[model samples]
Every structure is written in structure tokens, then in C-alpha cells.
Target: MISRSDWLRDWQLVTRTALLILALTGTVAYAGSQVPIGKPPGESEPVPATMRGRFAGFVATLQFDNEAWTDAFVLAPDRRWFAEYARDATNIRVKDLRSGVTLRRLRTGGRKISGLAVSSDSRIVRAVDEDGKPLAWTVATGKSVSSEAEAEGINRIDHLTIHRWDNDISEPPGPTANPGQLISRFLASHGLSEQLPDLQTIEQVTTSVDGRYVAITEGYLGHLTIRDLSNSSAPVTIEWPEDWCGHYLASFAFDGHYVVLGTHGDEGDHAFTDAAAFEIKNGKAKALWHAECSVDRDAPEQISRDARFYAIGAAPNGPVVVWDLRAARRAAHFEGVYVAPIISADGSTFAVTKAASKGRRMLVLRHGKRRRLDANIEADPTGPIEDGVYALSSNGRYFAARIASATPGGKNAVGVWDTDSARQIRTIEPGGDAANSWKIAELSNTGDIILLADKSVFKAGRWIDVTEADESLLRGRSDSQLTPDNKHALIKQDLFLASFTLREIATGKTIWSLQGTPDLGFVMSFPDGRVRISPGAEKYLKLVRGFAVKPFDANAKRQFLRH
Candidate 1:
């Protein structure tokens, strides 16, 4: 992903690239205006307001006359979108960009203002809060399905919530922002399975890697259950520990046998805190460990002292600590790094940084000493350099981080660095001392492209073509699904699935864009919210990228982590 300054970037280049692919082969646009390495998207302004600039293309946002309640929004692949909760102390309204409408008088149940997530189709919406609770409501009367709405070829409103909320139960604090149209929130609130009545509060919920099974903790009935999502209803349930904390349900072992739970440790993580570990097998949960932590389980003070969220790598390399649930011992610890970024298809690697002073390192862990990689990077990460690095491609080739310094009175873009040479490759968009650091949300498998986002949904960041290489995609839509080979792309859009069409390699014209009426496609949307369409990846590059962080929280209710 091309990192941007704290300024919210928009979705353009990727959309352009996708358009290029969907069109046909050999359709390339020549560049006229050159956005330099240090050029800000615009000149200085007193505050963070949306404006039209030469480089800031197609900016869109929903703002009230006198309100500071701004939350980021996401546009679905097919154009539907969802807004993060816009808050003041009292009134909470979500806006739709398409019709310039807001969900006034929303019939929501919870007041805690925890989180809100929208599905790609926008048919179903899930709401939750900090305390890991659930809220049900219909925000839109014009184009939304209620929890009880039912229809043919359309998802049952009942099944939609269970499935939608289940995935969101453990929002991982950030958007996935992959080229693929997958979104997850940490506090997804899934409905319970059968065979056990009188269910109360569910502590945690986690879906298996394959999207086959979902493990959830029900605090009310004192049981742990694994639901075979293959069938939404009648899911199987496992037993549980009497005093388990749902907040601690993050993840399990690779083999899926030993479940990792916090323990009553000698250190501060135990003694008084609610953090604990558990081992689940044969449909039961056994308490194994316990530790104290802040609400997010992140250790703000010190690691040996009271660290909550786990980090394995230092700044550029690793502080990563592999956990062995069965042995209940620390596996391997790479000191300098905090977390290993997703690697490329061939097992080439990248890392994330938690530091902010000097430039962080990006190196290849080839058998031993760091072998810094050198590759072409399109744009840098957006934001403060001190916040450290975010999304990196699979190969230890390039990195994205907040732009450290800025030319006065200008916006800022992320800084792309040559991990091998420890030199600045380029500075993307720049502006504002008020810029929120960009989040490294999108990454491609072939290490060809990436996406970056900030606090604003008005603009998104996409780095297309290349500053130094022939990385242009030949064909494919941003919404197109990747063929198994990753070399080709299939552009199919719509809700009912059949309404979607497939486009071939680049020529900048649609090979096929399926026609669908609202009924044939059956798309769910931002429940009468606003959304915009943008370009995605290109097909010309002939590459594929897939990445995921290791599951560290067995007690993971990822819902709490969603942004």
C-alpha cells in the first residue's frame, strides 16, 4: 500500500488500475503532471478539511455544518458503503453519500457507541460496543433489510446478522484493505448455536482459518461451542471453563488442538487482571494462564512488566514471540522486531515497526544475518515517521511508514524506503502537522501494489504503474476475484452472485460487466448510506499476493479490535 500523510487518501490508482485491466489489454494512460517525491496533495490550510486539488482526485466525504464527529467510511466493491459511527456526546447519525442522506432517528439498542460494520452488499449491519455487547436496528427504510426481513435469492436477514456479526466479532483494530473485498471488525457479535438454551453473554467468537468452523465462548450458559458455519443454524457447541474471560479469546494452535489461554502468572499479568489462557479440546475449555492488561491487552508500560497485546519483533526485524500452547512456553523470540509483516508467495518476508525515531529497518531473514532487500517502491507510508512502519510486501523488498518530516505549509505522503540501503526512496502525499498517520491496510501477494488509509474516508491511497519498473496490470477489475494461478483476474460484480460478470486483461474496456436489476443481484448496502466506486488492481503485472498475521489471541473476540 502507498502510505499517505495523516491526511486521508482516497481510492483512485487501484481503481484506475482495475479499470485498465477490465478494459482490455495494452490500455495505458501517459502521465502529464508529475507528483514529486515531496509534493503535498495541496497547500497548507488551517484545519483538516476536504478540498479539490490537482492531485487529490474525486474527493468525497459526508460532513455536517458544525460538527467534529468524523469517522472513516468504506466503499463496497459494487459501490455500496458503510460509515463508521459519527459521534458527539449525544446525537449519533450515519450519512449516505449517494443520496446525501443520513440515518436520522436510528432505532438502535446500545448507547455505548462501540463499533459499526457494514457488509459489502450493505443488506445487513452489525453494531457493537466496548463492553463486547450487541445492538440491532434498521438505519435505512429506503434500501435496507431488517433483522426480520426475508426474501428469495436474498440472504435472510436472520442469517445475515449471524454470519455478518460472527466475522466481525473480533475486528482486528484495522481494516484488511486488501485488493480483495473482505472487511472485518474486531467486535463481531455472532448469535448463539442450538442444543443449549438460556444463553446469556458470549465471551468471544473466532472463525477457523478455512471459514468452516467458528469457536465462540458463551459466558451465560458456561459453555464453549464450535459452530460448523457450513450450516448457520444448528451449529455444534463445546463446553467451557467456568471463569473464562471472553476478551481473552483470541486464537488457538495451528493444529487446532491446544487452545492458548492466559494464565495466573507470577508477574503483573496475573494476580488481579482479567486476562487468562484456556485449552479447548473434545468440546471443552480448560483454564491455563491468566494475566493483567489494559482493555486492549496491549502492554503500554513494559513487556516484562504488563504488556498485553503480543509483539514478536523489534522495530524493523522482530520482537515476535511464538507461543506453544501445549508446552505453554515461549517459542522463539526475535528481539528487534515487533511483528513480521505478511510474506510473498515464495516465502520472501517483510516486517512491521513499532518505533518512531529513526527510519525502521526492512530485511530478509535468510538463515541468519539480515539481508536488506532493495526493490522499487511507488509511494511511501503516510503520517509520522515515529509511529513506525506499516504494510510491507511479501518479499523483504520495500516498506511503508508515516512521512517523518514535512515541507512547511504542505500535506505529506508516506515515505517509501530502500530497506537494503537505508535510504529514502520517495515521499508520497504530504500535508498537515495534523495529519493522522496512515494505516498500512492493503498489500498484494506479488508485491506489486498496496493500499493505505487514514482517519478520513474522503480519499484513499493507491500507487499504480511504477516509479522505476513495468508493474502496470494488464487486465482485471478491482472487484474481480483472482484465479487460482494469480496470473489472471475475473471481474464479477453483484449481490445474487450470478449478476456478476468477468473481465479479462487490460485494454481499459469491459470484457463483460453483467447486467443485474436490484432483484437479480440481491446486493445489500450501507442501509441507505453513501458509497463511491474507485479503481483497483491491474491485470498486466501477472502476480498474486496473499498474507495473514498469525493468530495470537485464543480468547480472541476480534470485535474489540475493529476500527
Candidate 2:
């Protein structure tokens, strides 16, 4: 017999208390969960499904057994099919997005597959195994291919063509003629004028050392186009040979005078089979030479400053090889699994470590002679020697290696060595609270300075805490970016909600700050008025139509400078 209003008030209070308990206990049903602000519970904490902003609700719930499952799904460009990991994580299921029907199941041969991608035609699915081996499957036939050639062959397009801008013109255009106009005319002639509104998918981009030429590879067809920054009116288009199936890498050498193309195919243990050099002559690329070589996909290929030599190899164990590009021959070969093989600009010195051996011993090859230098640094058997752990100067005069702590719970350090005398020259230790997070160690080209992430900078033979110098804006921040000119920085702090601050590096003054919007996950819109959201974003899309946030515009940088 209680009053109706009094009864409703009591019910509301009980409901609110129940929700608070559910949020704190993480019993929420969708992929989203409420997390506490401040430091994460552990170092390897997974990203929360909640979006960033005050009063912003969860945007999506990511359904996965673990964090690794976040990248195991991909949608085709045609919007017809999508590929995702099966429940077992050992197989991939290609399903039609429109009907929500499973089309085919692809076996992974017991290897866990990740990085799933669909071809442009929606006929093939490609992924990489846990061991870094490439795998592919045909959607319709449910067939699998082990060889690189067969994998690429099934995805090749027959009508792929390259269009050149300067092909019909006998002379360069006058200054009054706009380069944009010329490009527009070329596109119209090729029946691509109406398609200009669509975004062009570029797989890779490389610029010449001199910064004059830029090479762009089309994502789907492997066609290449070279554009001169000085003369944008005349772009050279190079088509891959019909026999070739895929383009692995492209690079510039000899100050933009030579263009090197790496193609993958042929039966071998490696994916990169052919490395070809092309000379730029009269606004055209003429093939100079081609060599049968294998380059590791994960290793970063090194090219000498003068473009006279190239070194390529990878970890665990390696038969590291150095190639003399000018002479078209192999210069030197070292048979051992080494860590971080590097070549000097003058092609006179090379440094690498015998990772499998004990002690901090470095192998130095100078002028065809090999010597071992004892860095006098203790090795941490538990720590893995990753890419950024070691750095060498461009001249090879100085080499830097991360010194692992001698005892457990001890701090790490950096040791610099003079390659000529094979002696440790200096040891730089992390300062303040940054010692625990010290990961990336870098050496300047001249070997006069060292940078330990964004935390510390070693200059003039002294360590300076960069975070303290920058007014501690970057303190405790995991992700931050510095402008190329070193004048400004963007610091991002993610707690319960993400926030960003643009600060002046020298003055340590905050220029602007903004709250980040929640990540709605990956969404693909189709022409047929259908939309597809990733599994992680499906539930979140129903809660919010859009976000109100200020996005950074590159064109408005000048406006920011005025502030």
C-alpha cells in the first residue's frame, strides 16, 4: 500500500547500485568493460574496449579469446566476402557479408594464422603463419598453395596496365602549364577521370636518397609509378613483367640515378628471388642488371650511402651476404647467425654480433679483414637482442649496444665502442624513473650523440632527462611523437579516457589540448547502402551515431603556429 512515487524512487536507487557493482566487477555483457584510471594493472595489459571522452559510453565490444585475436579478421575491398579466424584459431573461415553465410573453411596445417587479408577480386585469402611464413587459400575452390609463385599467380590480374604522363609529349611543358592539369588530362585519356574520387591504395612508398624522386607501388596489381618531385608534370610508369607475380620491395640508389626493384617468386626458402637495378635515363628507367638473390622479409636491407654496397641477412642464424651493386657481384659473405648486420656508408666497415655465443663479442669486418671486439658488457640471457637494441654510426666509427643488467631487477645501460680501436669508449646510463622503461637506444650519424627513446638524450657527453626538460609533459606517457624540426611534440595519455596535448619542445609550453574520441573500430561502407563493422565494433555502433571531436588537419598547421 506504499505510494507509487515513493516506490519508484526506491527502485531507481537499487538499480543504480547494481550497475555500479557490475561495472567494478567487469561483468558487463558486451565486448566493452569499465576500467579504472591511472597506471594499468600490469605491463602487458590489453587495450580496453571503451572509447575515450568524458561521458562517452562504450563504442564497441571486441569478442576474442585473447588480445592476439584483434588482428585476425579482414574484409575484402569488394564488400562481398570477409575472412576471419575460426574458433579453433588454426583455421580461417571466409564468409559472405551480405548473407552472413560461411562460404569456405581454410586449413592452416596446424599453424596459427594471423594478418588475414582478402584480394581485390575477393577470390583469394592470404595470411602469415606464426613462424613468418606466407600462406594463401582460394575462396571458391578451398585450395591451398605452399609455394610463393602459386600464391601470387592466383591473384594476378591480366588487364593490369601502366600509364605514363610524358609518353606522348615530345618536350617538357612550359612553366605556365600546370602539372595538375597535365595529370588530369592523362587520367582522362586512360578512362580513369571519373574514378578520381576513389582513394588510391598504395602498398609501399620509397623516396630517393637525394629526395628528388618518389616511387609508389599500387597495392593490388604491383604496378609502379615514379614521380619526380622537381618536375611533377612528367611521371614515369613502369609495369611489372607479365611473368612476374608480385613486387616485394623497391628502393633508390646512387642519389636517385638508379632504381632497384625486388620481386618475389621462384622455388626457394626465401620469398625475395630477384633483385634488379634500373638506371634512370631521359625520364625513363632502363634495366641495368638482374640477380637471383634471397632476402629475408623481416630484415631491413642496408644500402651504403654511396650506393656502392648492400648488406642483407637476419636473426637466429644467417649466411649474411654483402653485394657490390656497382660491380654486380657479392663482396663478402659471413656464415653465422648474427644480430643487426650493418654496413658503413663508405663500404669499408661492417659490424654484427654472434648472438648465439656467450659474452658481448662483436664481429667487425673492416677492409675485408675480420676482428672480434669484446664490448666488456654483460649479456642478459633472458633479454632478447631486438632491432632497436643495437645501433651503428653511418661511418662505422662508433657502435652502440644495449648493455643488459648483470643482476636481476637491475637497470639496463648503453655501451658505445670505437670500431677502429675495438674499445668501449663510453657507457651511458638511464637517469631518474626512466631506467625501468628504457627500450630503444639510438646513435646519431656522427656518433657524437645518443638518444634513449623520448626519456633521455645524451649530448655533449652528458645525459639529460628529456621528460624533465620538457616540463614533464611526457612523464609517464607511453606514446608521444616529436615533430621533425624538434620544435613541437604531441603527447598522448590514455587512462579511462584518452587525451592529447600539443606542446612546444623548447619552452615546454602547452599550445593546445584535446580529448580523444573513442575508437569505433574498423568500418567499411558499401555502395549498395550496406555497412559492415568489425566484430569488435558491431555492438558499439548501435549506441552512438558519431563523435564530436576536433581532428588535426594538416592544412591547418599554419593556424596552430600562429598560436
Candidate 3:
């Protein structure tokens, strides 16, 4: 009787287990099964409802469908990165992160994107199109544009050449004992970068702000390659796509996630046909947004980014239109602002300088009211503002510019004007540099102007005459700064500080001197309680303004550096 009861219980447990297995398998079958959807096993996996690339990591590069060949490219500031094929090459395409995987690519459309900011977290991106003011899609997750199998017809001569960064040193990868350590390791890994003396023949060079990454469109659309600058010399390359018509990358930029491209060529002529925006995923670029624009060209042209606004205007002067990517259309329309519009730092207002007038050249401020501050000094017709010259500052109260006189003696003057009454306030005839050679890059109102000239930077104003040895010591060094008094300077020379000297503001004498290399460059105190020399590259520059020399308070930083 006991054995028979045990057998019945076992049978019941087996039955329950079988039921559970059947349910779980049924669910799995729905998601992944040998049978196809309403079909047989011939269809392996279900096709993605839509295919796209997601930015998965940093340091992504643009890969083109160049028949297994590779091309180097840059992202146009505000447009799509277009990749065209070589004239002799076919089968232009790129791989998924150098893997055998392929992605769906769109090769058309473009629009001016304003209010574009890289996401702080470096995930997604958002932009406003001042022209197409509609809140379309920010994430490069949607949209489809037309594309040809191979981007063939773009002109070769028109494309730009990229300067290659190469190095030849070997070392273990770790925190370096020297600045060039990484560069040395790279050279050691790759051997020597080919010396291309003829590279100069290929003009139209575009480089990153840091002069790090470079791309070239050469020989009338001939060859392209992306170099792993990690090792400057031997750039490891993943070439050509199998299926797509050899589409070589024309230009590219990063929003920290996806790589973007704007197409330009015979294939992509109309707004719907020629330009495109895409994102890089798995080492492949997937198309995002594309639009047809009134602009079209047989050759690719460069576009600038990082400006406050961008607009497409009709020939002549119909209306100045700004396209906002967020709004997806032309957002603001204004007249008189059509010329070169430079926005102030605060974003509250802007100064508009018209394209060279036939006989009239003037500068205007766009606040609530249209205000003219300077006369058309452009009447001389020699050329705008003389070569290398620039206006430093112009607030309704004070306007300064590096100007040239008609006569040779009419040298460049840092002119200041009182805009409230439009009267010349002070004309600082700070001698030096050709007409525009002097640019007032920054003014801390400490009466200092950092100026750049002939590969040399001068800290000038009434505040000149630092120690000669100190100046020589500071040569070839960047970020080392001089105190406003011309006395003490944070010296960065030959990788070490020769010394620091405190100067007399009135007579230009070293009152105190010290030695250290901890900080270098022209001294600038921030309103937020931070003191630094002109940051980074600004050290190699000379910033000229109305006040060639600004008088500063040693303790002014105690108060926030306010406007």
C-alpha cells in the first residue's frame, strides 16, 4: 500500500514539472524560435523594426563606404558630415567598429542648427534650427534620407587636405615623466610616419582646434584614411564597406555620442537628396536627420560651427533667417543683421558688421534699438580693417579697434570711442605690429593687453619693460604670465622658471623677484576668485584693445571680476 501511494505522488510531481517547462518554452518560442514569424526557419532572426546606430563609446571615428578604402574627415560645424567616394574607387562603405557588421546609412539632407549644446553627460544631443524653427528630434534616432551606393561625383580638387600628426617614440603607457612621452610611445609603436613633402600641394587643410585630428580629401576624390593618432606613424585602418556604393566621409563632428555627416555632391544636390546628419554606432554611421535645402553645389564647401546662430539667406538681401534645430525651421527673421554678426559673451546682444560696403563700412550694435557706433572707416576701400586687425571692445560706453591709417604714418591705433555720444574717447596709439597684427584677445580692465606678433607674444600697454633675461627665458613657453605692474611674472621657461619679478606699475621696474614654474602666462584674476595666466593658447597671443594697457588692482580679485 505504501509503495503504490509513493508512485502516485511521483507521477503528480512529473506532470507539474512538464507543465512549467511547456509554458517557459512557449514564451521563448515567441521571442526566439527556430520557426520564422508566420514562416519557416529560412528567415533566421526577426528584422529590426528600424535600424540605427547608437553612440556607444568615446573616441569614435568616421568610416566610409569606400570600397574597403578609408578616408579621413572632419565634422562641419553646423551641417552634416558628407562622405563621397573616390573617382576611381567603387563600393564605398564602412564597417561596424572595424567588425564585419554593417549598418543602414542615409546620405542626404542638411539644415543650420542653433542652440546646439553637447549634453553635459555626453549621452544625447539637442539643437535648435534658427531656420527651421521646429522641435524635431534631438537624438539622432529617427529620419531617413536618400543615398547612392557609391558617393562618386564630388570634385577632387575642392576637397581639403588634413595635416597628419605623427610621432616616433617608445615607452610604456602610463602617467608620463615628460610632455612628449605619449608622442614618443606612438612613434615607437608605428615606426616612422611617412614624410609627405608633397602633402603641401593638397591645399584646403582643416584641423581640429587642438591640431590633433586631421582628414584630407585628395586628388579629386582619390584616397582617404583615418590614422589612429594613438600611434602617429602607422595608423591602423579599417577600410571599405561591402554593400553600399563607396561613400567616403566628407566631414564629421561629435556631440559626444554619434558621428554626424552632411552630404555634398552630384548625388546629394537637393535638400532631400544631397545632405545628411548621422550618428556613429558599432564603428558604423547610421543616418539620423536629412533635409532638402535651397543651397546646392557640385563641390563640398566648409561650414563653421560654435557660433550663437546660423541662417540661410536668399541671394541679394531678402531676409536674414536663423535656423534652429530644436524648432526645425527658420526661427527668427530680421533685416540689417544680415552681415557678419558677432554675439557678445553674455548672449544678451550682438554687434553686426555689414559685409564690405561699396563705399560705406560701419559697425552696429543690436540691442532693443539699432545703434551705430563707428563711422565707415571702410571708405578708403583698401580692404576691411586692414589685414589681421580687429575691433577689441565696443559697449555703448567705449569702443576700441586696431585700425590702420590711409598714410603709412597713419599706423594701427587702438581707437576708443564713446558710443553714448558717438565721440572718440581715447585713441591709444600703442606702437607695434602691422595694422591688424595686433589683436586684443582679452582685457581684464587691469590695464593689460596680451598681444601676439611674428611668433612672439608681447604683454604691452603703458605696462611694458619687463626684465630682458626674463623675456628671453619666457620665450617658446606658453601660459606663463606677467603681472600688470610689469614687476613680478609667473615664468614658465625652458620647462623651468628662471625667476619672477614684481614691477612698478608707473615706471616699469621689478620691485620683487622669485623663481618658480608652478603657473605660467599673463596674470588674470577672475571675478570668481581664481587667478590664472591667460589660459592655454591665449598665452601665445597679444590682445589689443582701446586701452592698450589696463591698470589693475592686485587685490581686485577679492571682488568678483564683474563687468
Clashes of each: 133, 4, 112
lDDT of 3 by residue, 169-203 (tens): 36455543454333333333444224333443332
Residue-level lDDT tens digits of model 1 in 331-415: 3344553433333222234333333244444444422235553322222322213222344543445555544456675554466
Candidate lDDT values, in order: 0.32, 0.46, 0.31
User: Model 1: C-alpha RMSD to truth?
Assistant: 22.6
State, as a TM-score between 0 and 1, how close model 3 is to the true structure. 0.31
Q: RMSD to native for every prediction?
A: 22.6, 25.9, 29.2
User: What's the residue-level lDDT of 461 in candidate 1?
Assistant: 41
Model 2, stretches more than 4 Å misplaced? 1-297, 356-360, 376-384, 405-410, 439-447, 461-563
Query: What's the TM-score of every candidate structure?
Result: 0.27, 0.32, 0.31
Candidate 1, superposed: residue stretches over 4 Å from native: 1-243, 246-337, 356-396, 406-411, 432-484, 487-563
Error of 3 at 156 (Å): 18
lDDT of 3: 0.31
> Order of all candidates by lDDT, from best down to worst?
2, 1, 3
Compare candidates 2 and 3 on lDDT and give the better one: 2
Judged by whole-model lDDT over C-alpha atoms, candidate 1 comes out at 0.32
